[model samples]
Target: MKIEGKNVFITGAAQGLGEGISEALLERGARVCIADINTEKGEQTVKRFQEKYGQEKAIFLKVDVTKADEFESVFKDAVSRFGQIDIMMNNAGIMDESRWELMISLNVMTLVRGTNLAIEHMDKLKGGKGGLIVNTASVAGFGPGFWFPVYGGTKHAVIGFTTSWAVRTHDTNIIKLFILYQFQCSKHQTLIEMQYKFCTGI
Candidate 1:
């Protein structure tokens, strides 16, 4: 499906892969909200996109994904700015395996909260248009990480939640669900799955 004219809200969009996705989407004519805890980097991302894609194409929000209120506010702000949200990318994550609690909090709990908020805002039965919710999962989600059990578990939870939720809500016809697995495997594997399930209108 075409991404043109879509309004995308991406968490952890200040740098790294999130930033790259934002740039790609903007190039495809989608307006993006770059949300992250790093205000400096987030603003810089917005500035870079604005310079390349025009000032109206991007906005930045200082968001702490661990906070439900802040997470929800990003959605509200994006809607207020762009009229509606067409895509929600729950992409914020951390890799510190030593602090298991911190890892679970950021990787697992925060995603659960974000998914809840996204459903509330995007559910067609709730007086809103449907949208696509693309979650970021990793290869570790599907296999064991002998080196980092805690980190692996979080990603495993992500895949579990995303798949189960997708099946549970399958008949709703209100939102399209997708789990974009990070290509940590060989380059050949990357060509095998795009996992881009376009959100058909509700």
Candidate 2:
């Protein structure tokens, strides 16, 4: 489908791959909602996009995906600002060292909360063609993760969610689900499938 004219809400859009994806979508003339905890950085990114492409390119939102209220409010605000939501990427997440609670909140709870909010908008599609949801995961979920056991389990959960929900959502034609694993963010981040682990001796 054509990305132009589609309303896509992206989380964790302050930097990294999320920012890159937002830039690409803006270039394609998509209405993008750049959401993240780093409000200043997020707004700055939007400013740069607008300066390059004119004023109506993107909007920035300070969203903490772990908070149910924030999740709900972000989607609601986005819908209120822009007619409807077409695409969603549950990309706002964090990394912690072997902390089970931190891992669950960051990797799993964020996706749960964000998807719940996003699905509310997605299911309201007319003609069964609103949009899709994409999730980010890691290779460690499947393979043997040496240190981050909770992180691995969380990704396994993400995989399960994507596999089970993709075909069952309301808008079959509108809904497309994508999952990515083991994308190297930087040298410090380890790819479980790769042998060279960044063993920081933490």
Candidate 3:
């Protein structure tokens, strides 16, 4: 699993943890597709990456991850641009208790959709090269969060869904699946450490 020359598709990559992961990937010579709902920020991020990593190292695709069709299209467009995606990172999520339903859609449903799309596109059995699928979860998923009950529940769902897929896909050991438990810390530091551990099998 060399990072150089690999193509990565990442959601919520316009800012925060996703953006940090994208930066680390690009630094390691991987081409990235930064998918996010924020068109302005996403494009801006891409521009910065392109300037630093070369004009073809990264691209931004505006995407509403909750929309299955739009999300799927992002994958297609990314593949069309990069030839293939070697890594899929489902990092789009929200922590709004006032909008719990949208939280579920973004944190849980969209993650599942993204994982499925990754499998469909990268599974060796499906006439494609195998790749890694990484889903971001919170520490709240492992326990109760009274302050943000619904947000915690969505994180719980993320953990459950990702672990279930890992178990189900054990027999077919081509495509790798992982869940990244995000902890409270400096965003870039934590994500860079976690991404290093996972990508390098350290």
Candidate 4:
């Protein structure tokens, strides 16, 4: 596995897509730290992962993605354990509430916070050389489907932010910048292994 020894951090990782990714990466021999708002589900997810991937390979942290302080602490915790966050998956997002507030936080602010939080720790990960961010940009971001306007808008924000993040990486005195898009939900091991190979070219 390309990321076999690398450290990984994932947000919204208590269940669903986040859980899948964490399991996949851990199975490949990457140490992972899961950040989730749902502490109960997060612990449960960790239990399930350890059952299969082994206890030493994975961990979890309580993180409210909307809060920058919590996001900052996750970086510290991940770094303390693995000395870096070589790969970070910003996969937390939602569309549950009413339009205005939901769209504002879910679509725009969440992605923005994830990006900012990752950037805050990128220097330590690569010895100031920059790193990889696999930001999830939905197919919805590229198209506006009926009844999905708000979700689509936030997805578009993710896309735009991804591009901007790449272009600006150099400004921080870092190089070898990388950002990728995930359009759909595929199985965990398959997609994670593929991504590790493609990103690291191993």
Which candidate ranks first by TM-score, i.e. highest? 3
Error of 4 at 11 (Å): 0.4
- Tens-place lDDT per residue, model 4, 1-202, is 2678878888887986667667667767888888888999999988888888888788888887777776777778777887777777777777653656755675578767767766777765545434556776666777774676777777777878777777768665433322333444455644564456444542
Pairing residues by index, what is the TM-score of model 2? 0.83
Better by TM-score, candidate 4 or 2 = 2
- Residue lDDT tens for model 1, 1-202: 4689988988887987677667767767889998899998989879989999999999998988888887788779888888988888888888887788988988889888878777777777777677777777787888888888988999999988988888766554445454455546443344233312222221
The clash count for each model shown is: 0, 0, 0, 0
**In order, what lDDT does every prediction score?**
0.77, 0.71, 0.84, 0.70
**lDDT value for model 2:** 0.71
Per-candidate TM equals 0.87, 0.83, 0.91, 0.80
Order the candidates by lDDT, highest first: 3, 1, 2, 4
Which digits, one per residue and each the tens of the lDDT, describe model 3 over residues 68-155?
8888987899999999988988999988899989998998899989988988887766787877788888789888988999988988
- Superposed by TM-score, candidate 1 places the C-alpha of residue 129 at a distance from the truth, in angstroms, of 1.1
Q: In model 2, which runs have C-alpha deviations exceeding 4 angstroms? A: 124-129, 170-172, 181-202
For model 4, the superposed segments whose C-alpha errors exceed 4 Å read 97-100, 124-129, 170-202
Candidate 1 has an lDDT of 0.77
Instruction: State the weakest 10-residue window (summed lDDT) of model 1.
Output: 193-202
lDDT of 2 by residue, 1-202 (tens): 5677878888887876677667666766788899888988998899998898768778898977777887788788998888878878887766665467876887878887777666666665533345777777766667766676666778888878877777677444446454454545552242321212211110
User: C-alpha displacement of 2 in model 3, angstroms?
Assistant: 1.5
